[model samples]
Target: MTIQSSYPYYLANRAVDANRDLEVIDKHTGEVATRVALADDAVVDRAIAAAVEATPAMARLPAHRRRDVLNGCADRFVERFDELAEILLVEGGKVIKDARGEVQRLIDTFRIAAEEATRIGGEVLPMDIAERSEGVLGFWKRVPIGPVSFITPFNFPYNLVAHKIAPAIAAGCPFILKPAEKTPIGALVLGEILAEFDLPEGAFSILPVPREDAARFTEDERLKLMSFTGSDKVGWMLKGKAGKKPVVMELGGNAACLVDADADLDDAVERLVFGGFYQAGQSCISVQRVLVHDAIYDALTERLVEQVGALRGGDPRDPETFVGPLISEDDAKRVVQWIEEAEAAGARRLVGGERDGAVVRPALLDRVPDDCKLFSEEVFGPAMILERFDDFDAALDRINRSRYGLQAGLFIRDIGKIRRAWDRLEVGGVIINDVPSFRVDHMPYGGVKDSGLGREGIKFAIEDMTEIRLLAIREA
Candidate 1:
């Protein structure tokens, strides 16, 4: 079942194969769908050096040419959109529809990067403050920070990686990418498409290296910046070892959604269900916690139970399958363990809590204890904890109790309460009437506290990969 290309990876615009390979497992059946060649430490060094060697050409490439390359990449992605979606289903375990959405996002990300390529500029500043400086002028525009190193997570193998790759291209920065071992196919295919472009040789590399063997990508001082999108534990550890180079971290979060007394009950339940279970709840901003005001708690709970109970769970290839298997059976069991422990601690399991193979049916629990693993940590599973609160202040305090503060959702129609949420929430972005999972490609998206550092949208990423360089001239 070699559904993807056979090339091990793309390095310096050439396909390279390695002696060792890692099994790419299909989460549904726990079967090896394909094998991806693993990069050795020497391969890692060569990839980085290739990117470094290409830096000068990439940096000097005109913005128009960069824009054309990015647009060309987007065109190539559209041509193989269905193929990439199927690869995402096989290697990433995403349902068909969700997989297609990821593919579309990949296209959109690159298109946005193409649009931004020509817009990279800085404002002119007046330098004639004194008589001696009357004929002087000063201005600054953004320039490529040089080569970039990116390590993307597996959950969103296509779109998340695009957030890193497309921006680097727009800014004319050579980048070395290390995709997650479990889901490296989409990235490798992306690298293949890029290789067909007129990009300078050694512009980029996409290799799958085990986390333990990835120090060359992280600790190397030659790379100007490193953009990491993954769990907090690993992301932070890599940041510490990344030397003095600027680092961007897109770490995990345990996001929450609040339903107030005056909110639209019907709308709130529908959106929350989607948010809590979408992508099997693997998103960093998934709705892990739901705080409902006591006034509408019972009604919302009934609706939520009905909604979550009806979601279909099964194979990733199934179009109707609303929930698919976790990345592995161990991950599914972890979700199950958390739900069972919460139930033992006196939490009421209002709905599903059974697991078959790697698929854990959507589990909805109310009155879960504050100390439960599901409550304190990022579950990354199809489970959501609901709690009832009387006062809004107390609810805000509860929301802020956790270390992670990526994003939070509030459904408040009242002006005062809406203003309060906007003013007081500690998260990066607040959703007015929707769940925290709501993210558009253009908006600046990131978090505070333990969730991570820096924003990841296309334009924002261009900002991270480029810095201002000022040039001043004086008439003699």
Candidate 2:
């Protein structure tokens, strides 16, 4: 059955067939609820026009006023949390309980961004470089960069969308949000909520367009920035298309989590199970590879095997379910293929190499060869390959060997060893004594190397979104 909201989900340009134009697919039941108008070049042009027209008014709104607008939306979102959670469950294949948490994360992201709005300020710089202008007073003002275009991904649609949308509004920049086509409803509802706050007609726009048309939205010269979160390949391509436009791209992560000899194996195991298998390992920061010290490798693997073996896999709506289906049946088949390739190339699936419908039990592998695709590529599914290392340096070496270095986790008690790992690990964020999956709403979250550029979260992203204009004055 196609689920329809009693209210219209699309905002701004009143196009009736938005639902059909976008082909919004239901990940759980694999059905199309409504065709969301896939923003074509023309729709993108209109959205851009709307945003550009709204930019001046948005910027004129005092930061405190902007906070009020954002907080209003956040309040509505929290009040109707259940409705948003259901949309996440049906559209993203997230289990009911996890789906609810996803909605809460979005709410938290908005609340944080709202608070950050009033805190946007610039610094003063002394004109010491110019001897003639030494007596001049110099200061700087932080202002919005006009219109911003947010292209969010399917995973964590609500929260990630909030990451982009909330900050854009808080920074006094009008936005045109293009949510992932598959999970557009929740984002659309968010835009609708912001609209309820009597925001200027063009303050923000959300269009559920397909991937092919996303570039068209960025093609407009008025789009001052493009904030995106998705796969590395696509993020890079978008960065290139964005030209000189500021781009905040949060890309893929084939993250490594190291378990050292001087660590807590039980805590590491528990966090890994939650991080790796939760969301069916579709998370970018999920523990894709674990580099365990040889001293505790066998013991760690045994506990991991037991924990993974006991996981429940099935209907996402069940609160007790440990694992849910992949985003789609095709994705499930692809994940199976990835595991099969790893096995054929000399990797051993220690447990759970089974699939029923879109649901696949989490699979753990050991002795995965360096030449295997599972080791070399981003296995963005519910499977993590295990590698054994004998020394601290060796573990660090193995962890840094992968091209994607978004975030890394190390379980260690030795301060010296932890410091050494921190020095050597080439990642944007590192978690000591915790798994890589741990991320708070306000932290500077992004990756190094092929993981893309810039950062997310309200504060850092706001810094990237605006340009500073220094002002100097001297008495005549």
TM-scores for all predictions: 0.97, 0.96
> How far off is residue 134 in model 2, in Å?
2.9
How many pairs in model 1 have backbone atoms within 3 A of each other, for residues 3 or more apart or on separate chains, i.e. clashes? Answer: 0
> Which regions of candidate 1 fall more than 4 Å away from where they truly are?
129-135
- Where does candidate 2 have its weakest 10-residue lDDT segment? 6-15
Q: Write the per-residue lDDT of candidate 1 for residues 161-245, one digit (tens) a residue.
A: 9999999999999999999988898899898898888888889899888877899888999999999999899889999999999
Model 2 ranges off by over 4 Å? 1-19, 128-130
RMSD of each: 1.5, 1.9
Q: lDDT of candidate 2 vs native?
A: 0.82
Clashing pairs in 1: none
